[model samples]
Target chain A: MDPQSVERPPSVLLAHRMQGHPVLVVGGGVVAQQRLEKLVPTGARVTLVADHFTAAVEQTALQCPQQVRLVRERYRESHLNLEPYWRLILVCLPSGAANHSDDAKGQSKSESDSEKVYRDAKRVFGAQQSVNVADVPALCDFYFGADTSGCPTGKGEGQLGSMQLLVSSNGVAPRYAALVRDELVRHLGELPLAQSLDRLDELRAAVREEAPGPEMVAVRMDWVCALTDRLGLRGAASMDVQEELKKFKDYCKERGEQVKSPSQDN
Target chain B: MDPQSVERPPSVLLAHRMQGHPVLVVGGGVVAQQRLEKLVPTGARVTLVADHFTAAVEQTALQCPQQVRLVRERYRESHLNLEPYWRLILVCLPSGAANHSDDAKGQSKSESDSEKVYRDAKRVFGAQQSVNVADVPALCDFYFGADTSGCPTGKGEGQLGSMQLLVSSNGVAPRYAALVRDELVRHLGELPLAQSLDRLDELRAAVREEAPGPEMVAVRMDWVCALTDRLGLRGAASMDVQEELKKFKDYCKERGEQVKSPSQDN
Candidate 1:
């Protein structure tokens, strides 16, 4: 077996509240475009620095002028310095171009350049920053092998309430990771996990208003588990929301708890 | 609708080569244990700094003496100082405990304590490090919601070649994220994406030996795509590997290329 073919386990991290965080993205090719699409939804303040961008990336910039900033220039050490407090830097330059400078001395030069970018980001942001060098795993602090096909646009009330599923292969086979992710998306779509979660949220809120205690916390958890099982057995779409809510209220009432209807709270 | 229920997009990052990197995991609860299990596979040098340990975490430490260290104490700011090059810190204490000191001055105490941990980690490791304060989204620099149910052991040839799937919900709903992840794992088990990836790996090596060029790179990518489609249509376990290899060789031979068999390399 080839040593390169050997897969290593990955450490996965999910970043929340990237809104207004400065992100520096180098290269505007297909990979950069994909990264941008993922980043934009996070409400990140993204600045794309590439000598030339693919038509798709340019279109995305035009579409989200508030979120994405376009800087049409080749990557340089100065690019890292010129950022408005960048927290994450994504180098999406093609691997072929990077490998072109991979001879003994050429390798060090490219490696040093990549290292400098990471070092500079660290110096500026203080170890909270992450750098992803596309296709160059050795130079990257993080990898971007996420299959985000199931991600919902966080727009309006309904869309914001939906669940987002992301699968990462951690620099393993991209195609395989994508295949598995696509399959997961399909299976997850068939379940009423989202609806169940929404109901749980409502139930939890009602429980908190009525009786907030350690015991109630466990009760809420038990209720969620039981509801999940019921939803799993009977399709979520087929189940009546009013019936479920009524049953839930009845359960609380039996326990000598006064529960307000979720609709009443609104 | 509660503003907190609105889902925000997540920035997913996969860290590479975590071996020997110092990881500080606070709280030895089930969440901490789950995080440790995922961290151990990455070969991360972990230090579980908790007041106590779960039975399973203790067993894990006994099994992997070199990889995991037990602090056997409550989390303190000074704990970050005692480290062998800390890169990541996971705070897995229950949110209720974290929010216990959430009054006027009490809130500041806990917030400042959390802040100090993050600040100290950045000071020691620079901005390249990540800090995940479990359940407290406000205090965390990153969230740990990865469902690594399909990760391989990363030992020996066969185990090293398997794919790892991770799903993160970015702290929107942990239970929902886990439910979807479990469903995905079940569906992915039915696919032959991993086997197809192994075949692609062999094919890539053969291509590199015979026709190593930019053109070959594109050809390899195209071939992988075609093979993925074929594998999707045909059950991987039922399909004949020998026949597929023969067909692959014929396709390469048509382009005036000679390919070596994967078995021959072994």
Candidate 2:
């Protein structure tokens, strides 16, 4: 098939794993607070450097001590390299960030506080760093998803489940993407998605054991694809596990030559 | 609110823009082909290094010449330093990636081809670079979304338009996320999303002009949020622009103090 036949998007969307990764946020205002709120959920170890903190920001830092570390000091270039390397360097200062330090105020006059912070980060971290400035899309190495999809945060009991879904509009229409996510959460939240997902994982392990070896690699892939398409996550938990395994073996005996549609059989 | 009250996800999901950015892929087989297919859509300039290529992989490189460049040679350590720095270094090889180059084969025997490739990438690129090995989640810095959401590619006329929605399941259950994406595509693909977004931008510009000043920042934000909640992207295009602007001015007259619910007003 012609590659041109498939239209390409302008940017690639990826889920940056920040469970234990080091990230830097260099401001302490509402925007900083919002960024911190989002990052906290992703389990990132964010090191925030700001002398003054709003009541809300301090509360969050104090509560989620594991995820957030507060450094009550003004921004400094040394903060960029405090650790070996920061996975992401995010500056959440408002445009024209005030220069509270009177000593070094006259060195730069042309750029705003935002621009100064961005420039300092790039200069200190070099070209290898992925730095993002708040409200500045042009200088961003990546953009966070408008919101998370099927986050399972609202998935009863408020337990943070292992499963999460993120939705992005690629910066074209973030608000709309958030609306779409709200609708998805409405549909997905109602289902016992977490329970279904657990069951699906168990079924996958059984299938893997049943079809071992490189010779059965094709069989394994096809069966997995077919099962996912037919039952989705919900079916695994709802269906009889042993019965499904029997049916899978029967299909494998045929070498999966024909299209396997469990939906039809059901 | 207590930070522990809201549980955080295990990872942070983000959208990484790859347009015109340099990326290195260290294999050219089927797994490499899949990564290439995904990368091509993001407009990444991928430099693939491999002694051999699959037919499908060759076809893609030939078709999308701008996005892909072929290096007809085995992956060398020098490839890691080819440019200023690689945003992502991806190794796509089957496990126990055979040492095709036998001269150095005996140097490493315990590790399989997959493990070797992953090791080489980390050793060469250092900890600063985000390296990924295919099928190796433990070695990945980030994971791609299950599927793109509301991509305007399917929006009639086949023109790659701006505006898209992406959904991810935090790698907990990717297949389940893909199923969720299919549902999102079905609901969103039907709307005149791109055109509506254009209208929304125009409306936002008009609102910004009328409510110019830092004092009206709150008013601007609330009105825009209310507009999105009430009409969404579709309403921006469907409604009379002039009439909406007039109503917006009336709200500003009231200083936006009361809870402004455009849904009720509409």
Model 2 segments more than 4 A misplaced: A1-9, A98-108, A124-126, A149-162, A190-192, A209-219, A246-266, B1-9, B98-108, B149-161, B205-222, B242-266
Lowest lDDT block of 10, candidate 2 chain B = B1-10
Candidate 1 residue-wise lDDT, B34-125, digit = tens: 88887887878889987789999999999999999999977665677767456678877764454332232424554434455556666666
TM-score of chain B of each: 0.70, 0.73
Query: Positional deviation of A217 in candidate 2, in angstroms?
Result: 6.0
Per-model i-RMS:
3.9, 3.8
lDDT of each: 0.60, 0.65
Error (Å) of candidate 2 at residue A92 is 0.7
**Pairing residues by index, what is the TM-score of model 1?**
0.76
Candidate 2, which CAPRI tier? acceptable
A9 in model 2: Cα distance from truth in Å? 5.4
Tens digit per residue, CA lDDT, model 2, B162-215: 544455555545666677666656666666666666666667667767766434
| Native contacts kept, each candidate | 0.35, 0.58
